[model samples]
Target chain A: MTGVVSPMAAPAALRGAGAWKPAELLFWTLPVIGWFAFPENLPLLTQIAITALFALSLDLVLGVAGMVTLGHAAFFGVGAYAAGMLPAYLGIGDPLLGLVAAAAAAALAGALTSPLMLRGSGLSQLMVSVGINAMLYEAANKATEVTGGVDGLPGVENTPLFGMWSFDLYGRTAYVYAVVVLLLLFWMARRVVRSPFGVSLRGIRLNAARMPALGVPVNRRLAVVWTLAAAYAGVAGALLTQTTQFVSINVLGFDRSAEVLLILILGGAGHLYGALVGAVAYMSIHHLLADIDPEFWQFWIGLIFIVVVLFARDGALGAAARIRDLIRNLILGRGASR
Target chain B: MTILFDGIASGMLLFLISSGLSVTLGLMGIINLAHGAFAMLGGYVCVVALDRYGIPFPVAVLMATLSAAAAGVALERLVYRRLYGAGQLDQVLFSIGLIFVSMALARWLFGPQPQPIRLPGWLQGQVQLPWIEIGVYRAFLIVLGLVVAVTLHRAVGVTRFGARLRAAVDRPAVARGLGIDVDRVFVVAFAIGSALAGLGGAVGVELLGLDPSFPLRYLVYFLIVVVVGGSGSFEGSLVASVLIGIFDVAGKYYVPQVGSFIIYTVMVVMLIVRPQGLFGRPSP
Candidate 1:
């Protein structure tokens, strides 16, 4: 109850409330470039964009705030079911309003669950977070009248984007719409991560005990960030429902929670872009491996998790940094080793 | 009355499954998410023995327990040993990998179906009493659970090994200086924990049902028990299991609609009231 705190520190590159690097902007630009290059794979790219947004939301709490969450999909699932169900049941087809409502609903849910989570030790907090997720999932399972039980909720309708650019069969509208939201959120995430609030979050991640001594309201900050992260994830989920017009019980599953965690770890958390990078890699591998066998794909993902944990401390970003260092050392005389 | 019996019986099974994980986590400071995999392995072993071969239920149960404990020892040596002092995330990642691999193995070996279990005639019927109607298997489960609980309580609470193991976990350097083989204690404790989980699985198949998802499905139950009982306390696990078991059974029987939501709600409320669990002492 008292001292189950995480000891992970925010990496230096993300600690400063600073200006965006040119390279970071270029990183966001690459997806748009890919959109133009691969016209036939817009659907796949849309899915990736949505997933990257989900992972980015996770990075806020996990990497930036230092919370070890395992049930984030609760917010995501809640948002999806709400948005998807609303349009079908309540006759609200406007996608913009749906997105706002979904984010608010998820944020509300996150606020309710945060106090319970904040009271426990690290592991217990993890258990409680997961426990809430299970409860939400079970609720969805039983509320068959609305959720359609195990058969899944179908026939959610999305109105045209701002009265223009309707979704077509080729998925062009969906990809463009999703990417715009993603870029806006990604920009916001960058700003938040570089804000003074984000700097304090980094401090809390490193040492919550020390932060309270330094006049920071540690638990309050965590709760706020938790709620914020939940909203981000909710919007991401709404995006999925908005784009695909499908929401299944699987949305609230433990697998989704676990997969999102893996994506964050793979992309090398703490930075805003890690989620984007990791999602692209993870979803690509996921897409590629599903061609062979679905069950076995998880086996490879698991192996990737192991490798990332053991060798890549910061995940893909960490590995890329190491590779860059090696090449630099080869090119230069490895002066100062930095 | 019948509800109480079923709850206590189910709770006992949960305790047995999580007992190893609780003790090992307390003693080793590692979260073995793959613990349920061993339980599934036990169920598979028992099923293969009974279905593929003609082994008796009792013998198959014994074989399953031993084999599971043996697997625990091997994994502890080869895999888990390296993560003795590792971060929780690392431990989680590594054990999660084991889970995926075990799931694949189960599917490959068992062909993605719930393994069939045949109880003996004595265990297959019901015992109709004036006060309560009980399945013979439920009665036996209650008895077995009580016996295991008492035995484990004695082994961990009163025995010399228990005293040493406590010391080893609490103060490894001092315990080593005092001539305690910390490594040996960990290995033995881990083995016992795995064996108990296997025994639980072997006995629980008739009630809980076993499929490829068995490990992941029941994993939360085991975790709730270990966590709510206090990470390393057998007595705590026993109490939590009974409470959760009855709560779950009653919820299902009475509400039906809520099912596990009731249990999870209780978990949240309980955690809010006692974040360290009802019995868990705050760690330094």
Candidate 2:
């Protein structure tokens, strides 16, 4: 665990990037530039944005909180099902309430299962989570009346946000909404990582026995962190359902859980922005590779994984950072001229 | 009564698969997720030998079992050997990767669809008892599984190799200092454990359809058995498997809505309250 970057080291990397220091200035200026310059890329960017949030939510447990969950998709699936079904079955047309309900349902489940996870180590926890997810997926498959089973619950008509912003195919409203949510969550997560509670969580992750001996109440803190992470995952799932307007059983599948875990590890666990970079890079490369050769895409992806594991231990984002540093040095030629 | 017979039959199959996993995990501290993958490989081999190559069923089963044992030995040498000193997280991730590679290879070799290797005519019919009639194959499976379980218990409790394996499991460092071939013992331990998984897969394939996805799907089910029975205890797995079989049948028959989740919930509760497993003594 030593030599790895701890989540508590968020010392705001914005100490005068030469000129940009004001948070308000960057917030306003970047959005205007992005919206005006890349109007055509908004849809793709939006998908990446939501996925990035999903990955970040996973990192809160896997990376920061040190909980290796293989069934984080349980929360994600619950959120999607809640968002899709509440409107279709119960006539709750309000998008806001659907999202809230999705997160709340997943949070409740996370809270209930938190005690189960508190005692087990990595493999034990992973097995329990996998079993839980599989059972849920089977239940969803069997509950045809409620879930519509494998055929999926369709005809989910989304009421416009605030009764105004209707989701469009071009993803104009969905993209903006998703991006805004990601930014807000990112900001909140950053603040949380800097708090005293986050410090205690870090202590528990580092040395559980020592921390409990120091009066940390390690088990309870684990449950709290796990529940919070599940809530975030639930919200991300809700966003996916709302944006796509379709919910499938695959959302709770093993592949979903494994891919999310891979994305987090590939992105460098403790680094906040690594998840975004990992998700965007992974999805983009996967899409490109699949399009180029449908049948043998896995071969190339496997090769990429091996290279990343061997050479770039931190992942694509870490490799990119190294390349960027090299280029900066090459261009700048030396330290700042006197 | 027929339902009860069927439950017992299925419970035996579960016991066979889970007992091996329990031993290796208890002894070596290696979480071999690929154990099920080995089982699937064995099932496919048996299917290929019996159906495609016209081999006798018993001979095909033996060949499949040995082939799986060879594969297990190879895995122990190549992947697991490096992972001995690694932490639990790395072991889990690496084994997951191994599962993926093995499954992809199986799918590539034998397409995605499930294959049926017809049971011999002798195993095709049902046998009637005074109270109930059960599938002949199911009866054979239950008998075979019981024999293996009893043999394993006696071997581990009484035999010299079993004593050495047990000593290694209980205290590896001490065993090594006392001149035991600890490395060779681990290799044989994994090989035997995985061979049982292979045999279980071959025998149980008729009950649970043989497919590439079988390993990934049933991996956690066996893990639950291990957790509930307490890892490393063959008797515990046997008892737990029957208990789970009964519980699973009851859940499905009555509260069909929450069929599998009941077992999972029980596992979660057991894990939280007793991390050492139900009958397992806490590892030192």
Predictions' DockQ, in order: 0.59, 0.33
The residue pairs in collision within model 2 are none
Residue-level lDDT of model 2, residues B15-78, one tens digit each, is 8877778767755678777679888988998999989999888888888888888988997877
Candidate 2, DockQ score (0 to 1): 0.33
Against the true structure, candidate 2 reaches a TM-score of 0.87
Worst 10 residues of 2 chain A by lDDT: A329-338
User: Which pairs, if any, clash in model 1?
Assistant: B20-B193, B229-B236
* lDDT digits (tens) for residues A18-43 of candidate 2: 24225334433544576777788677
The clash number for model 1 is: 2
Q: Write down the lDDT of every candidate, Cα atoms only.
A: 0.82, 0.76
